[model samples]
Target chain A: MTDSVFLDSIQPLFQDIHAHFTSQPDLNPQAAWDELVQSGFLRLLLPESAEGAGLSVAEALPVLMAAGYWALPLPYVETALLYAALPDALADAIDGNLALAVGTCGPGEPAQPLRLGLHCLDALVTAKDGGITVAPVSGDVEQGWRLQGEVTPLSQVLDIRLLGTAAECLQLAGAMQRVLELTVDYANTRQQFGRPIGKYQALQQQISVMTGHCHSAVMAAQLAAGGMQRSNTGLSLDHHRVAAACGMIKAACQPVVSTAHAVHGAIGVTEEYELHHYTRRLLAGRLAGGSESRWFEQVGQACLDSGASVFDFTLANLS
Target chain B: MIPWPQRQTLPASAEALRSEVRAFLVAHPPAAAADVRARSWMGFDAAFSQALGERGWVGLTLPTQYGGGGGSAFDRYVILEELLAAGAPVSAHWIADRQSAPLLLRFGSDSQRRELLPRICAGELYFCIGMSEPGAGSDLASVSTRAVPNDQGWLLNGSKLWTTNADRCHYMIALARTSGQHGDRQQGLSQLLVDLSLPGITIRPIRDLAGDAHFNEVFFDNVQLPHDALIGAEGDGWQQVTAELAFERSGPERILSAMALLECWCDWLRLCEADTGDQRTLGELVSRLAVLRSLSLSITAQLAQGQSPVIPAALVKDLGTTFEQDIPAMLADQIGRRGGEHGRVELMRTLAYTSIIAPTYSLRGGTREILRGLIARGMGLR
Candidate 1:
């Protein structure tokens, strides 16, 4: 599974970011962005000719995962996605924290709420007029490129949405892992009825179910990430990618979220404990951009439209 | 942490294998009815299995020395996907191809492997697992079956309950107490490769809810086994059987049990204009299937790399079975809501068969509770 040599080489960068955030949860956004830029993190998806790291979305998935692991309060996930989707020249010229937006950013259109680190966003990457449009938060457009037809832009928008959702799903997977660890630690230590709660069959059952959900969440995210990578390279049915992203988000929003707290009992609710950081972000990520129902509907329609059998459809898109 | 490694797509080589399997299925499609095909791996046809054996598709993972193909796990995975997606009847040699051969290869003695592996690879021998007993279902460690030492070898007593296809199988790898008492649980247990033709053995087929007689209750009345029947070292049955369960739980069989019915439903959806609700339901089911397959494939990769991945396998089986059961339940809801307007008679028939057999998905291999407990312990919760 660890086939990417470049991913292996950049392991320390992810570790450094994880370590930095774990130590200083309140670190300034600009300071973190500068450190990331110096490490060539934002340029990971750019081509080598542009002095970028030349990493695929699949290769840089771990970075997004680490962002969720530490609950890093920055726009690294959005910025990384933009780098993957934007043109090489424009990606090279970008110089500030990035955020993603959907829908046309027309003059009379209402202000879009940035999914993450809104105050830190320099440019908002959005879809407008059948193409990718970059609108600075200051109400001036930096670059606007229109493609030939409505279909391409819609597909591009779908790709961006799928990538963004998949990225957040990876983050959710990371946070879920930490939540599992925290709940497991608590279950093993917290005494109940004169014994460790973890020893009880009841608690063990719930934690086991939680563990299953955590593993499934990871699987869902990886499926989506594979879709993202394939969408970048060449031909892939959009329905499968949309379906995978929906699955990822739905898994993240499952009962695992609440069960983590249930295992922690009252201690999980206290601010002194660290569980809320990951849990809160997990909750937000599920509702961000588009909900699971919306994306799932697209997949549903696609399934109906695809003339192939469901098995063939899955093999065509998923494999 | 659950070692959910990064997702890896099948190699380019898999496409060739997949095409071959699909072509083979088209040439030798299961002649059973739609509902029978909905049974998928549970539908038994010895002739079809022998046909697969002739094509070197039966025991693809076993070494060639045993008359096998000596292929990797991915190769078998590819063939299995096509077979399952087409609802091929593979139950005749399912247990042997899936785990019995692997168990024997790993824990059986040289003579035992030499005698049995070839037949298994040829799909001439059918094997059933004798793990659960009348008293022990999910509590497998509490098995009461006894294999006491005797002048002949061992005198086996007690019975195995819920043993699938025991009547048709040539042999059984039974978990019995070799030394310890009943409450000793996992201790003193040994797996014995019992020839089902032994004089004192009796097998009775049990009828399931779906009117199928796949389940059997096997009674051993002082059935004697030779000295060479013992698999692996004495008192190592628990470990051997645990490894065997991993193989049983992590395969494509666990997740693709309802593919036949699903394919049928999708065909109907295409013919009839499905409403948004029907579309959403199919979409949800498809998404879950994609993710579950991804999880199962990850475990297969781990197995390829020589990792047991016990917990991940258990987790997959649990989630996979849940997804399997959800197919019929969700389809039932959709079919119920439409008042038979969109549901074809054929689709309803397949759905009825699938719905009746869905509960077995969780009960077979390992029950949901037992699997969850294993996962919890793996997470260090117990």
Candidate 2:
């Protein structure tokens, strides 16, 4: 059942959605949100009994590809994952009636903790320690409202709300792929010394390395996702596998994205151009998960536990 | 857009298989006395391999009619994981069971499969790759080996370098130029199954850094093969060899080479935690290892589904080799500088051995450059 939807419905939807976003210049989160809501993008993962598309993981990959391609900045993903557990009234608010924002509590807090006493809601925020919180809100006209904190850089904040750490990694990987493709295309089409720059072995080598990075990043994402999915399915996920994927992703994506920026040269970092958006996202995404150091520690422990052999560590975990 | 599950799911039977392999490893660890510095793929213990065969573990991926267990790819993957993780001496049967048998199953003539599959399944026959020559390591088309057609069969001439286990193998699948000129790198290249024990073939052992005779230089002078000894057909060697490499480059072996040493270091670290100051370094290593394993397992899953995933496979080999090589050096840095007792000093020595040998990790299957080229081509960069 899941396989069919993935091959038929979601795959096509993803391709179409990606093409739509790629061709469009002004990709606004607010506008994307409206289109997605109207198209039921937000409800694909939710159960059909709950008025959602009720797609499984395989079926929902297209949605991720769409989000990744457009670099869409909406909290659709966070909302979808957390929707079932949300309070009844909050859930109602999220049913296309109101826009919602959800954030995870920091570490050492209770599982699923919610921060209460926050403003910008129809009702006061309430929570059990670390539980997810949903607060309904109205426009600025509401009384007794006090701004508790300012969410700066609306664009960046929008990305955080949409992707979380894991999705952010995926987005960075996708962005890196896009950048490589663009750079290669540019190198081939741009003429230099009576031929395309790609004709030069030096430039080809650089592009080749960039391509390697992109490949590594994709593998890292796939592996990380595979581990997380295994955990969800009640299989013991090798912590080392997760850490290694995270480390590789961090290691590979940063350099690849930066090299791409370097390859694009002056024009890449300019504000007027769109390439900076991806570069910025890639930079920001790297920091979202524990930094390289943090992931490196995780990887080290896994290696040590498996007794320092890649074969042993992996085989033991798999077994 | 909704996030993909981002996790791999293995069959439940894998757990049972793991336990069985683990028990086997505990009961019969590979002979530690043997040169520990041999390349993991080239290092082998015939006794240990036979033990595995006795338990029906050899050729786990082959059909039961051919003395195999007729298991799924996951089962074979589990077996390999266990064998490699235990640092078991599987080198003796590694190529035969891992690539040769599988390749023959897919592409060899019926007689070839029937003749070799049982022995491979029983760990009685060993095979070596006669692909690389002195001049042609990654540029396979540069192979100078020549096979001349005769009425009876074909006569192969030339030498293969870096032929792992060639000295001890029963047979070799030699890739030689069958018809095309030296300029035609790809055309007329064909794979011929040659008996290593046949006259006119000589094997000279090559001692590696670890002081182990893991690889050999195999010289073939007018070595004759039966007409049916050819795998696939004339001028089909490039395709056959490429497919075979896809098998070789992909698999648990690519990622798990340093797993045993990593495990040993972990144990040592635990014993010396009090003196190590903080465990933060160990924690980081563990995380990195986890991601590598995850990436490898995901590739295994893809392979199980019959997807070649060539680029991803290359990525796994590259990243995996990098980590494998890094493990010994990183562990040495942590332990070598310290003033330690006799046992601790010996441990450091072992780690040092691995460190020196690790550099070849990327060079063996294909160099980092070759892998990157393949990856670029896969990504349409070429």
| Tens digit per residue, CA lDDT, model 1, B18-101 | 888878898898745667788767778888889899999888888899888989889999998888878888888999999899
Q: Which regions in candidate 1 have their CA more than 4 angstroms from the true location?
A: A1-26, A89-92, A95-110, A114-117, A138-158, A230-239, B340-342
TM-score, cand. 2 = 0.81
Judged by DockQ cut-offs, the docking class of candidate 1 is medium
Model 1: how far residue B238 lies from native, Å: 0.8
Which lDDT value does model 2 have at A96?
48
Candidate 2 lDDT by residue in tens digits, B1-382: 0011233556889756988888888888664632253345666677777888888889987888778888887788778866776667788898998789988987899999888999888878899989899999989899999989999899888999999889888999888999979889899899889998889998999998767787899998888877988888889998887777767776777767766566665566657652322244554445455555556666777777776666667766776787777777766666655655423554656676777778888898788878876765554553
State fnat for each of the candidate structures.
0.66, 0.35
Candidate 2 docking category? acceptable
Whole-model lDDT values for every prediction? 0.76, 0.63
- Local lDDT at A152 for model 1: 23
Clashing pairs in 1: none
